[model samples]
Target: MWFKHLIFYRFTQPFTLTADELEEKLTAKCFKPCGSQDISTYGWVPPLGRHGDMLTHSAGDFIIITARKEEKILPASVIRDALDEKIETIEQEQNRKVASKEKKLLKDDILMTLLPRAFTRHQTISAYIDRQEGWLIVDASSHNKAEELTSCLRDSIGSLPVINPPVKNAPSHFMTQWLSPKAVLPVPFALGDECELREPGDEGGQIKASKQELTAEEITGHLDAGKQVSKLALSWDDALTFVLGDDLVIRKLKFTEVIQDQLDAINAETAAEQFDADFSVMTLTLRKLLTDLINALGGEIDEASRGEYIEKKILEVSKKQQTAEETAQETA
Candidate 1:
């Protein structure tokens, strides 16, 4: 299946687990339906859904996995109504007001009682570990969901050494620069018609524009006024289109006709065959896209470079603080 959103992490060290080893580890946390009283249950599932029995699907050097989470849906209004009735009944019987502490306990008890009857919903997060590339790209729009999958993997396999990919330059800075007048975008990257711009600083407001020329005078006017691009829509070599955020999250991904034509040529009939073909194509395309993107944004900061960068930043901050303290002393 195609991922709608991507939140990827870089492995600090090489991932060494073989496909069989990883599969065995994941089985210990195989997904199960939520119990009657359980509020939520999360575990690994077969990436091929009902088409295959293996929880981990190996495509060359990539190992694809899926995590399923089933959670009970207890409406807040219903819970509030139930809690109110219970509290009223208790108050009438005892002739005393309920304290905040007791109200919390009552809420917990209400949840426990409601969970069994509450409707349950299920969602799955699919991700792949590109052992060759040292990246774990999750099909989740939010960081929390990506973390959930990574946490489960850590719990299953004992250790997961990954971090958000560090960059040599801020993405916002480069993205804004890309839209400036006479600025040429990097190879394979062409601007689209959507972008989000925001003023600098914590209190700065933001503006979102769609179906408008990103490099037009009207948009450049805002950039001249000190706003920076926070989210930008762009296409990579006409293969994929996506919105790139300042945090490096990719959203609103769409595959172009070129990719669709490739899939069509596969002429796969079965569900499993189609899935395998899609996975292979998607992963290969993504590897190239990510490589070009990282290079365009001034490349990823490796561990050694990151350590030096952090140290330099710390010293700069210390120097500024010292200067401020000296100024304060002089003023006093």
Candidate 2:
């Protein structure tokens, strides 16, 4: 599993659950197929699939959890055709029009009947919790989808101490400055032709430009005339690119050949091995890029704090692994 997107959040308080403790709690919520009568199902699943028993995959200071959502896909056209046929039969037999409520009931019944035969769609959100960093990173592109994963995790563990981290300096303001006349980016970020500019206040003007230099006079005039950038498309060292939003949500990611080429060369014997290699390559590259982006966005963080956090978390993880091994031995 290569992580595609990120929705970053910070923990407001300590999340002290050990790997064994978290695994035990999540086992009850492990994912299962949607039942015949149910339209959907949601639960935790092992990141390594069936190869791993623990629902949470722990690596040093980081633990990853995958949340799967399954939903039945009942076509509207099918339901409408079925409803029309039934309505026609009823009208012919009763020689009368159906009431509104009766029609609604009929539609509901049709949906329930079709649900069992409907195709199923599955979506999984992989979330990584950095124990020492106190961050819960979700590979989710949308806010509602990420919240669904958070909500499910809360239901399982009975607690979640995380919330969206506050952004001090607005991203729009910074992005506009970068695209301004002869602007030099802080470090790695560079302006691309793609940008969504919106006029602030009641006037409500908006426009999007793509594949055109952001430094064009027309674009600068809009910015000079008070249009704020809500979405700034940016690239980094020609290796990675993403749309940076006003809310700091990164979307529409495209990694260059430099990053993808490494993973493409990997030839693993098992699904687990391939997944691990893919994940390691992606995570290592992304983690560094994200750290730089946070700094560029003025999300000030102490380096010493990070070092201390990682060290402490690694020790705790080691202890938990040893204890789990001991428990297995005693059981044997």
Candidate 3:
């Protein structure tokens, strides 16, 4: 999987360098000769640091070097002596290049800290460091001890600043794809386990029915009453009743169409009223009504004319209800 990775770092003081300039400086300073071998022959692995600043490296088994902006350079001799005393299989050339790269990398990339984790599992770490702009990116696959790794690196480097990469908000089980077949298999069930089982026609048994055999009549009662149905003017009571009943789905569709029509009518009226009166309020009302209609239909209404009509209808209904309540209170 391709991950969106970032490097983070902090500086004691601010320093400035363009991207190209920083890159060039790091390449020059970090790449050094090993004995008589040409520096070019040695591998000059580019430094990876957080926020692209703070070059870092495993100086030896016991030491880590973290260099930042304006920090004094640790002498090559000091590094050589430390490695010879502590680290085994010391390659003079490789050690020099590694140390040089650690310092130079810190000055190239700069960024802020976002996430930090204890290094407890990795044996080798990928270090990213940029100091000029202030960033450090570190990925150590070798160090598995988080506290030991972090503490060791911090202690040896004189602590200019250290940062960890951001914790990704990735889905759990993201590595499911990488799991081995054996690891992914389900556990075997033993015989005579207490799992639920049933015979045909057993008491409290699971019920099964075919969709083709299940008719609407079986679910809902027959509506054979010879009652006449008539189309009625739109009202809040009727609308609410439809919404809270089985007719809600069909009613919603019809209501949305009706609201659209109303919006069109309002727009036409507003255009005509532009010469006679202020239709601003009416326009606003219509817009609100259209919005409600769209909401009722679980859709979006973006047209201004439609929104105005919807708003007007909603306000009119609200005012009517308020007036009715006031009259009832007066009578009481």
TM-score of each: 0.91, 0.79, 0.18
Best by lDDT: 1
Per-candidate clash tally:
0, 0, 76
Cand. 2 Cα-lDDT = 0.81
Q: Which residue pairs come into collision in candidate 2?
A: none
Please give the lDDT score for candidate 3: 0.29
lDDT of 1 by residue, 1-332 (tens): 79899998878679999889999999999999999889899999999988999989888988899999999999899999999999999999999999978998999999899898899999999999999999999999898798789889999999987777778899999999999989999998999999999999989999999999999999999999999999999999999999999989999999999999999899898999899999999999998999999999999887678777656655764696699789999754
User: On a 0 to 100 scale, what is the lDDT of residue 55 in model 2?
Assistant: 85
How far in Å is the alpha carbon of 60 misplaced in model 3?
34
Query: What are the C-alpha RMSDs, in order, of all predicted structures?
Result: 7.7, 10.8, 30.6
Clashing pairs in 1: none
lDDT of each: 0.92, 0.81, 0.29
Evaluate residue 316 in candidate 3 and report its C-alpha lDDT on the 0 to 100 scale.
67
Candidates ranked by lDDT: 1, 2, 3
Local accuracy of candidate 2 as per-residue lDDT tens digits, 1-332: 65667788877677788878889999889999999888899999889877876687766667789999999998789999999999999999999999978988999999889888889999888988777767788888888898889888889899886656544577887887888798889777777669999998757899899888888999999998889999988888677888888877888877889887887888888877776776666666766777778778787445556455555645764686699789999754
